[model samples]
Target: MLTLIQLILLLFWTSVGSAGAEKLYHRRDRSDVRIVHANQARVITDKHAAEVFLSRYGFIKPVNWEEAQFEGSASAFTDDFLEDFGDAVLEGSSQHPLRNPAWDGKDPDGASQSFISALEEFQRVSGLPVTGVFDGATKEAMNKPRCGVPDKEVDRNAAVDPESSSSASDTVNETDANRTATNSSVSADSFEDDAYHLNDTDGFDLKGHISNNTSVNGSHDGDMGNTSASTHQSQAGHRRKHHLATLISKNRQRRDVSERGYVAFSKRLLKWRLIGEGYSSQLTVEEQRYIFRLAFRMWSEVSPLEFVEDMRSPLEDVDIRLGFGTGRHLGCNQRFDGTGQEFAHAWFLGDIHFDDDEHFTAPNTGSGISLLKVAVHEIGHVLGLPHIYRSGSIMQPSYLPQESSFEMGWMDRKAIQHLYGGCNGRFSTVFDWIRKEKTPYGEVVVRFNTYFMRDGWYWLYENRNNRTRYGDPVTLQIGWHGLPKDGVDAYVHVWSRKRDTVYFFKGTRFWRYDSENDRVFTLDPEGRRYPRPISEGFPGVIGPIDTAFYDRRDSHIYFFKNALVYAFNVGANALARGFPKSIREVFPAVRRGDHPDGHIDAAYFSYTHGAVFLLKGSRFWRVAGSRERRRRLPLPRNGLLPHEEVGEQWFDICNVHPTALKLKR
Candidate 1:
């Protein structure tokens, strides 16, 4: 009978090496071997082999060979071994998925083309001959099942004890030896190695080595000793380690959870909850952790929820708390709050606080509200989130401010992305967003009808429209109530003393606003550059959407409704001048060859305004002023160049596509 030591050495020499062991069999290449002799190899491949194998090792469930292949020659045995083998897989073995024999080697082969490869792997992990064939040694090792050692075995004589001989003690018997080996948990190594504990760090090959701690024989002992002798010996002194690192604690409010250690734990849980629902999330693990840290800190003065991680933690004193200051919030700090739809304030990004007192409301005040919704919104604020204007956003400031947590929404996620920017993936993959301090509004504050974006849609100053000769000449106050959808009077139309026209009359009502200082009145909407490009302190300029202008003096922003509409307004100028001059910069979508000049792709517009003027099959503008309103500005150069800076009044826009920037001269 092949001794366990001999069989083990057979495996190690054939497979284990610095370059990793290779497999002997693959699921694909099995039709090759017709005969394999292993009786002397102690590998019982007969009809009774499986039962004998199970009886040896008490680990995992035993095989139900009700399906054993009792036909053919060695083929029957091989098939039986394979079937029993599938059972071992169901039971997770000591090797782990990574070290599993199935994964061994660099075979450019498949399950069919490499039974030898798989067999090699099995031998390597099982400590048998990894010769790429089901050698008698391999079959013997596979028959040796896995098992745990019992205390009784610790006191028993050695497995090879010669004095304890009995009728079952058949020295040349392969089945008996395999039985002893499987049941003995300790390979001569585990029972003998002096350094096999939790703290051992020997075989750790961060960049090298195969596996740690394997059983091998010694000089006086038999065959297993030479089996990858070096590797097993090297790993004999090492310990196993798992890869998770300690989480962090961040005081600064941010939207990641990983950095906040304990705090991150809560935030991550919250994110998971939101994700479970249909809500869109824009926070990442890192950002969520940051906010969670703050929440943990601030949780002191405000107890919204309990800080219970798992079922463990001292519950001796139901009221016991951690850290300084206490009156419930546990002395944690409660710092900021928000003002309007633009920003919602919070103390710490992670902590959840509440007031059991009177009825209150927010942006400004109030405490008692939806715990989840408030927590979500405040959690955002804690993460340095500015407010998003999307009507459906969670941070839109339209919900009750007192709630501990707010619901998540698509808009809320977008606003977060705008500030911090995102991976540019499906809106779903984005996480805690960041926002640089960039105000696109005025003294009072005014955002663009829509964002200009990384896309240079609003890069120019005055890209006036082509004048259409029509209607009479008259002048009057020009303004719009809003763009409400219902049948309302004067709300969805643009009117001037001349004849009012509804240019972008489509959907939704909105508030009207202007930047800090730039406003004036003009008889023509397109022909004149008020204060001309020369008037610095005067209302700078007004142009269609997608206009960008370079100015050391003022902020240059444009407006758009359907097709791009960029409005250049300095609130101070508007408060002074009766009306600001509005220009129409229209660029229609074009197909290849449509324009020999290769300009104009698609038109962009906002859904907020009341004036949409379609110029032609391709161009459309907000039709206002007299029918004789002339587009006096020089036409543009078609696209943005590398070293060009757009003037405050003379900007550049994509006359054709949003991606292509056009310089309006």
Candidate 2:
């Protein structure tokens, strides 16, 4: 038998070993819990990100308050109440006008403040509480419809609603009632609907007249099917008629007889090839290919049109052929002056030719013509849009070197939508795309440099080799000063030879970020235009930009809003003119033209393989050259496709952990 001291020591060592093992087991269990929590949280985070993304880019204007009543619904109140509401909130009445306003009419920020004060004064005069909030009774009073501009006469023949009623202050008047009659007999006979068409000779015109009876004044349909809030309607009483006249005048313009308006290819799917002569020296072969691809993608996004590159041979029967030619180009009767006269031209179902004699710039050199701009315009002709006289139109008769690249004017979008129908689904922002990428364990954010944006919070991913750690989550606000009341739509980190800035897009505005100091800066510091309108900062551009990224290869930053992509030159603080191109044009194989359903959630360049990766839903693609070569990613191990519903895996995993331990034992 062993001695008593030896037995005691042996028993003590055994007990100590058992206790240590238990402690280690508990620690491992806690680690697994944390991992599981992160996975579970990903979906919630992504959902918020998606919502913010959608809100920023969608056509819906940000309302001041959800509870605010608008003018259209306040017919129970007197017309005087409506007219007075407009005068008080918009132009201001004599009795209750704004006082001591700081704004000089140029600064939007100052103007907003001045407008609020005017509202307060109006409320005080109207015997309501003097709150500047744009909701409830205040919103109802402010949104009342009124007459057009005093100086300019809106053509009565083109009027949408030829109402001549004076507002009733105390009681209705018989004369006013007759003048503001709602009968269909009151019509604008001189307003020919076909006159609004691009080319009457082609027997092509918009199918139906734009609706004139909507109660909401200054409300316009966005290109992406979102409701763009009317900024100009803030002043109009007879807003509908005024707005309609403007549209009609803008649509009716001079065009060459040969270039008929609203033409479209019969086939939804078509193949295009490059001639053996290749592209102009202005842009590299790759750049030209991308630009052309971009042009086609934009049209496809809004219509049932798809373009595929004919990689086989130029001799093959292709729907469209592209090449460079001078003077008497392509053996066709059409000729080019080669300098500034005519940059490029394309006939329906015919080849698109670029002027070889003129100097060209791929993006912009400020020394030569822009190839991308000319390509978009020529492609419009190929797709069946005649030259329009709209100031910002892509199909304008002459090439505008100063216009933003891929600038699809409102009229252009409406015209194309009229021809091919509209986009299959509502436009999705870049964030919406990322959220759709359902990872097996949920989407884990990747951090590069000092930024760590995820959903509504930001954190630092700390690691010393394999031991990974995360800092406390900080709520991301508009200016990065404190806790954010709401989530952001999209975030981008730009690092290139031109700029070192991060951008955060939210609502109708975006903020420039200073990563080094963890602060946000406005576009104009003196003006305090931190949350400026997208149009103000970027001419011919609207927001919210769904997602944005810096392309190291091209040294350009791209902003994706809805179905279009805008290229921004950070160094120049200028949007690369002739931009806001369609994604389908750049990447053709992703979807058919008849069904442009999906959107790119995230995009990144793979320097390792010299290709670009675009993620859509659960699948990701690797695209190279002008053509899109697609390879699908493997499905989840649990056999769940991204769109398919499946049972929860975390719960199943948790239940199995204990059993797994017992099995190991």
Candidate 3:
């Protein structure tokens, strides 16, 4: 007497089988499996099918021990910490390495040995150079998520009803029917009490989860936005969060650090609503909104996640909400000290409440608390980021102000990217994990700027002084060192024995910078100084230049705009007679109409190869004198650039070395 819905649930459970031996129906080829429901076949992956079954039965996805395994080798320093920092941070646990590995769980000796064995297995499984020791690489591998399971604390086992005995034929042979189910099923409604429960008396009880519990001293009358070096050093002395976590034997039940609680959204696009009114009268509503918008944008700059505002929705219905509150408001017992005490607090994938009593200031300057800075930190919490121990990180528990600059630190980027990866099919690990190939030439450092060909962004880096140092990032609007702010359309570095300069071109205008002198001067068509229109700089040249480079052998500059290549003598600053020839006419390998855009994006002279490379999209053509010699650079066997496959945006070339061009490491 089972209903149609009950029959479907039963069929799904039959397919999933028992807990310990969870069935993974998706093949390595990523093809969907076909299942018959009411005599109709439908295609779905095992994970999706499991999600559907859970939704139908109103049960949370089960917590499976197998999902806790770390997948790949950890190369990053943070990766090492996360991998080995299992459950020692749990509130009630004492299983840190400094302390005893034994916790409440049984098998003390066995657990200790198992940990070492597990570390070895992790190294081997992660494809690390196994030394059976807790090496750097092995530690990083432990931090990454595996088995499609996130780092968040998810309780309960998945709910899938076993099918009727008559439906035995529907079960697949690959599934283990005899395996044991570790956890019993619980109803979804009951999960609410242990989840996010808001009490009328006590404020919001977020299942007792406090992502980062960094202690904040009493309210400071002085400005909290000072980013002075002395202040920074003082703040560094403050207690920071540890990477410790609690672990209980093979069960591996764990918790993150006190000030480290990160939650992830089930969906990519999170919709949010603002519940309460303005927290402080120091700034206008528009100003506050602008501050919040900037905060959200700061995070979006690095992560694949996105947030949208849903103005016309209930706070509870929205994915997340923000508003101001006072003591006892919304059951929040933690009262705000009217002065510049606790700025605000937020829950994981939940509401953000500002202390309405705190004196707030929109600008970073001023004695009052910087509302913008606090907003940025609070938004980090709303976006599932816990309080990070790193000082430069936006997720850091305390705020250190930089006069005006607002950018996510390297740790922040790495952390978020680790969680959700980057957008636009980026973050490939193909080439990054491979061992470096020895360079034919001596070792050289490649300054791989991410904004290689980006329209408006640019940066400078120098590594000769033992350590890498670079100027702050700037956009086209704020030209650096006398360069035009309009944006650099094309650029090149001329390594001449007499004079070396980095040239930047925008529209018909160009500028040359002397790295030695730290001076920039406008350049005419010829290498001479003084600003002039492109037409005047290079006689007979029309339209914007896509790219330009000076050949050391010929001592002439070649300007590439669209399909046309215009050559100009450096000394004369005048075009060669009958110039402006089509690239297809000069280089036979370049098809006449190959690119729909009919333009060469970039070109550079390679001294190692003794040739010039003309870049178009993902492919490039290597060419020498005239129509005599030309050949397209070989595309990778896998048909992806090293940088592209390794999830990097820009290809790095160092010292004009051929080995560097090959990108072995």
Candidate 4:
């Protein structure tokens, strides 16, 4: 029995509660602002703002006051505009400022001409209309989220000069421009954060080390926007800068390579670490380190370099130190703009700083900026790679949203290899591991995995992913129990209607393997002990074989030793007639002098590609298969195809440093 006023109050409160709950739900479902910052929401509201933006990002240079007045364009270049321009550009290129005088008002019309040319260059790189005017499309692109690294590292006189340069519009078509514009609009308007989110407040000065105990939960005390807190932080930053200058003077003899092409590390083995104090609040410590390990491993897969995480080493000894920071967080010379626009920047052969203000997510979370992608791109910069302006390249200056399935592109691989050559090493053996499994419905399926062995270590290559397992180059003793401590010479798998057996060979001895048990068989059904001599197993085959593989079609084990091949018939348990032939006669090269003629490393019969490959050193040659036999220009029987580098086909089968062999899980 409620009164009318009481009933009305109850309904009103209920509606308010319901609305609040609904707002929370929508906020949780909303995607993060990956590329655009809220602070830059209306930064380019007018033409004057646009000019300031251009000048800040290395697009337009500051005009000389005397020359500008001589050209009668002094009104356009106000003192405040010039001052802001100088401050922004100086901040952007603190390490390497653009010193070319050609764009700094040398010609009377240089100021106006340079402005138009810079606009055209910006539009061209951004995939927008090549109109030199400051249009709406160009303004939108400038406001979008991008890497903090300056786009034009060197002079663009040849590229932007109207008289000398080719038409910028010739590269991008109308369809591409329209699609880019639409995608950009969708990214900016629909996906940005609606509310301010507090970032990790861990106080770290620019000194490349972290002060962990200074904060709780790795966060600072006051709000980042607090005026008093920022003032105190600014003063603290000044002290760190003075300390950094002292360190630079102590190491004054160190030669710095300014050119990107010559900027690679002189050594192959490099050390990297994420500063303890600079861990991101968005991800756990393990998640951040794992992401970094994978990123470094990706580069190692394509090149001869190897990366190891060294936690015990001194800060100065570490080759590359990475950390997350807000404005003036790390003792870095360059400051991060709060959220949006510039996400991260890297110093050549030095440290990397990420803007923690941005929402960074783990790999494949499908919401925020991908920390892994950003890491790989930054590592490229540290390794001396300049920003590549091509589609699908990870080194693009602007931040592109991650695809569902992304990988290191071809251009990226080749570019890195050009600086540091490919991964080159000899292998003891290489083979495909085959097994049979049944589905829940009792359907039998045959599966196989590829492995490469060197010394006592082996790599499990994921054919589907076109790379080795994340922490591969595992020791053989751990993977293949009861095998030789050093490594096996070859692996042979026999599959026939009457029998299925697996064998491992080392020196003069051979061991029978029980595939079902994942280990070598001590005693087989026939009462034969393991480690029987090769002479006893195959009567005609010699000891110390180079490599071997079983051919399913012929039901024979082809044993390779020196320059001859012994085709041993499994059913008859004897060498095939007219076998033990010269290697050249058995596997002829399709092209002259293009084969692993003799003393090969391994012979693999691949079920994936349905062919046989002869591996030697770092190269591999594919034997003629059924498809080759049916070709219009059919290859000769057992003809070896042109040899190609094994790394080119099987991506990223790299070795980890001995110290980093056992990961901390």
Candidate 5:
């Protein structure tokens, strides 16, 4: 028999184990809830219904039932089915055979070879078993709610295998190397681990087929008739040859640039709006606009592109227009199927229309369709991304269950970057601001914030989050009261046992900051007046320094001006002996001839990484730190690492539209 205390402990452990199991079960359950809306198309009940579903979604060419026969049950085909099918396919492709009714009956083996091949292709892409029959599993997959965009385009000539892309190997190698090198020094939070591989050679081409009114529609229709038994048996011999030929042709053309293409906007900065006439009835106008803004901002975070909501601009002037409507709504050429599998559709490099019949809701509502996810996916199409079949990709044709912490995956980021390239910008100053704070538990904590300034604006980067604070780029005057309106050249925080002070420099002047008061000091404790010259502050250092940073390890301030670095000792209030050194000598490049030799922008020592970074133009080089020394490698002390794009290291430091400079958090 167990003691009383032991029995209590056993009960506690059992409950804890059950709770962990429940959490795992909950996640698995959520993933299984793929369909958002309750009223999606019903399951395919018979062979006739399967044929119509397949035909409508660009599987087999629209069949002329009167002239053709299949091995399945014979049922009368309707003209309405053919007309709806024609409209749906024609919205995206002009070359669809159904566009010319005369060619519909030309293929005698359409019910056999073409039908089976289409079924297999659909099954393959939908992640189902390619049995080439109307099975129960296929019926279930066909009934799931998916994007209005077709899974397969009638005009798409080739399929690019993402595994074959060169970038995959490069990305894997770089990630592994970075992980191995920084494992001891960097926190897991600083690195994004989710990997979504993409094809590097596939470019989103914006030059082709600039249609002003093209749309991609998704819908379901009634059942159609089947062909006679003899027709299917007669064509069974050709099935293997036809399927093999199709696969070979696709593989052969995969690398052909002309075969793989998409549309994108020509310009970086684009305007968008939620038209008043088509706002969602389910959400308030403010809620709708906020969701749209966030969707656009998500894209802006990864690319150089910037989006500004233009409510007052003429509809035509806006680069992209978003709206919500039901059947035959929004002046779109295509009509939406009321609240079924098709939720919304977008024109390439054009407008987006959401089906109002669907239950669109705010993010993380847990039950309804996420308008934000839908909006982001649709906007991707407008920006020229096709349906990516990879799991975790935002561009997937079918909607996955809402993840509360869903973000744009790496593959999606690379795909968009392939079109517009990464975000790049120059910073006037970059520094990590350290301060002491008291917690509620009466514990003292040392905290720091990283900031980047350009021109008159500044952005506070949340190091833990690895992103800038949303709605950043606030003016310097607002962030640092009594500072120059045009922005500062550098910031240096000098901290030691006896002294802890902060200084901001711009042009020939420097200002002392009172961290306690959060403003520039007119008169310091040392009786120094405001806007002191560099010569007075540090006797041997020159005025108008390019950039400066205080090194905690050496207790000296290194100021970069032109090609020289001046090291000033804070304790002595003078330049150190052998102070002036060539920038290259002080911070030698690890790679030969890869240094930012002169005219440095900002020298920042990051507390998080425990290293100094030299920023110039759009690139930055990291200086060897204590971690590198501890490894006992052959790397030189203070040697500069290979230059990397600043945008890649510090992500989403993007500018917002001038009109949206004060966006609400």
Candidate 6:
């Protein structure tokens, strides 16, 4: 129905709902790009465009107010906003651009937690605090609103249809708040038509709905690449879309500034795309700063993040940190050329650094390759970008300045979209009615929440295995490990903001179940559980057993040896037990851990930055991403490698004689 979605006209005047709520649809004529008379086809309404555009930016659109009410909570900023944000949160969760809440749309409290988590996630990704509160920075990041300006007037234009039909206003039901708009005065002149569409003579009549002086049937226009539509809910109460919509009492105030059009224009930009400096290329201290700032602005976009916390209305919120520093390690920042092994690094809580010595040449010495392309790469690590297998890209551990970070290939774009989130700035509008509620902080309805491990939960590696685990990420650690009780087994635990806790499979002691008979066997020489049983009693199974992961989120149980993963639904019953059983779920050959194939890894539970890991040559690498907190540290010399590949892959964490890992947060 949205085939010609690009031809949208924002904030146009139109009538409300018609009888053809279903069964009919809108179609478009490509030749009808010219402007038409007031009686011509209705132009793409702003309401519809706003709905479609917002969803493109990783949001959702609600079918109606009632549906929005069902999905959100008192914590929701707005029903309309929540519905749309819900879609983005659910769909883009795997990449974790936003916080990941449980997928199931139940538990109002849990839903609130998810919202809190999403806000924190946005903060973390954008280099803000992990604190679950919507602080000033958080507000700035969430301030994107769907608005626009045109140079001319708007008129109905064209149509094409799918099997059924619907209208923009068909679903645009007025909530108690919006009901005021019906009797309210809108600056119709505020709708600019000339900027995007011209007042040309190419006019044509709409499907003759003019005689009825009726509004266009938006339901009829559904076809083509309508990604925004995909994220919209079919019905107000449908689970597919969870928008935040609300009806406000006429007490709503209006803006006073008449020259605020430019501000409004800027706000609309973020809805189109998330423009930013592409990946970074290596450069010196001053150079890095300049480039980073550019990249920072590029990523800012026009719209601020938006939410309707009960504390506030569905207003735009902008939250993101903008600054730059060389991630130069004290060793690396020796203020000299090529003396250290590392360049720069960024921590999750917002810390950045660069090498002081690595400067542009003399003469009119200008932009030089950065000393710490490694640092930018490291920051990428914190922001959720994984290392590239190739030896280039800023994300690649070994790539140097010669290989530009700015020139991203198609693969790079795809990878970013896959990791961070869809780059397109599609906008969705929802009325999140953030009302005064009970408990701590009455007005701010916290929809999401988060928590990182406390400092000292882990200690730096004192030996070999510990050495092979650093680079980007706040920290990395093997929190859990053990031999299979039924047989011989080995598990490697890992943690990080980049990936979080994971258990890699190593080896079984020496016992398992007989595949054919489902019988237990003592395979170990001792013939005990070591010679382990082939199968289990009712609760246990044998052979290449997986592990039992613990967490309120989507905890998992997996077998490293067999490369299998099992997901558990974990009902109320398992909530008490430290570990939930695999009631149901399966994954095979799904290798997971702090990383799938990182040269180094850190902390079982890192705070913000500085993960420690041993590399190929037995060298340790301190990887970190900077945020509002965190200070930059130099990379230790030759800390990236271990004597050999497995010289000590899984650090002897728990088995060590003394301490394990700690955070510098």
Which predicted model would earn the best TM-score?
5
Strongest candidate by lDDT = 5
List, residue by residue over 1-665, the lDDT tens digit for candidate 5: 99999999999999888873332212333442234343344445555556667765545532111101111111212333343233223223433333433343343334465667667766876788888876778878877777775443322212233343332112211112122111011100111223322311112221121111111122235322344433553243234224333332322222223211422355778889898899898999999998888888778866778898887977767878899988767655456776757778875556788998888998888977889888989998777666676678798877764656667776777777765666678898999888889999999999888999998888899888777775576878888998999989999999988889999999988999998788999999888898999898889988899999999899999999999999999889999999799999988888999999989999998888878999999999999886886685778889998999998788778776655555542
lDDT of 4 by residue, 1-665 (tens): 99999999999999888873432111233422134543332345445556556655545532111111112122223444443233122222222112222223233333366567667767876788898877778888887777765553321111222331122212111122122111010000010123210110111121111111111112334444656645664454334333333443322212232223333576888989999989998899989998898778767766678899889999888888999988766655556777666788876566778888888888888888988888888898777565665678787777675654566776676677666666677788888888888989999998888998988889898878676776577788888988998899999988888778899999999999987788998898899998999999998998989999999888989999999999999889999999899999998988998878789898988777889999999999999887887883668888998889987788766666765455432
TM-score, cand. 6 vs. native: 0.18
Model 5 quality (TM-score): 0.63
Per-candidate clashes come to 144, 21, 27, 8, 4, 197
Model 6 is weakest, by summed lDDT over 10 consecutive residues, at 425-434
User: lDDT per model, in order?
Assistant: 0.26, 0.43, 0.44, 0.67, 0.68, 0.27
RMSD of each: 28.5, 37.1, 24.6, 17.2, 19.9, 29.6
Q: Write the per-residue lDDT of candidate 1 for residues 148-216, one digit (tens) a residue.
A: 111011111122222322211211111222222111122111112332211111111111111111121
**lDDT (tens digit, per residue) of candidate 2 on 1-665:** 98999999999999888873432212233431222231111221221222222222110112111011122222324445454234223332322212212221233333244344444543543345887544467544332211001101111222122121112111111122123312111111112355454321122111121122223322223332323323333333444334333322322221111222222454567677767675666667877776676556555434445677676854535777888877655554444543534466665445677777667676545556677677777777666555554567676554456444344555776676555554231111222111113357897553332223335543332222211112123345533663234656555556655455556666677776555456666443445547657666656557755656666656667766667777877667677877867765544443334212234454544333344444444344554433222333432211211221101110000011111111100
Model 6 CA lDDT for position 366: 34
Q: Which segments of model 2 are wrong by more than 4 Å? A: 1-196, 199-263, 313-316, 404-406, 426-665
Candidate 6 has an lDDT of: 0.27
Q: For residue 390, what is the lDDT in candidate 3?
A: 49
Q: At residue 299, give the lDDT of candidate 6.
A: 22
Candidate 6, residues 98-215, lDDT tens digits: the string is 1223222222343244344444433443456788564566554443211111111112111122111123223323233222111111111221333211111122332332112111
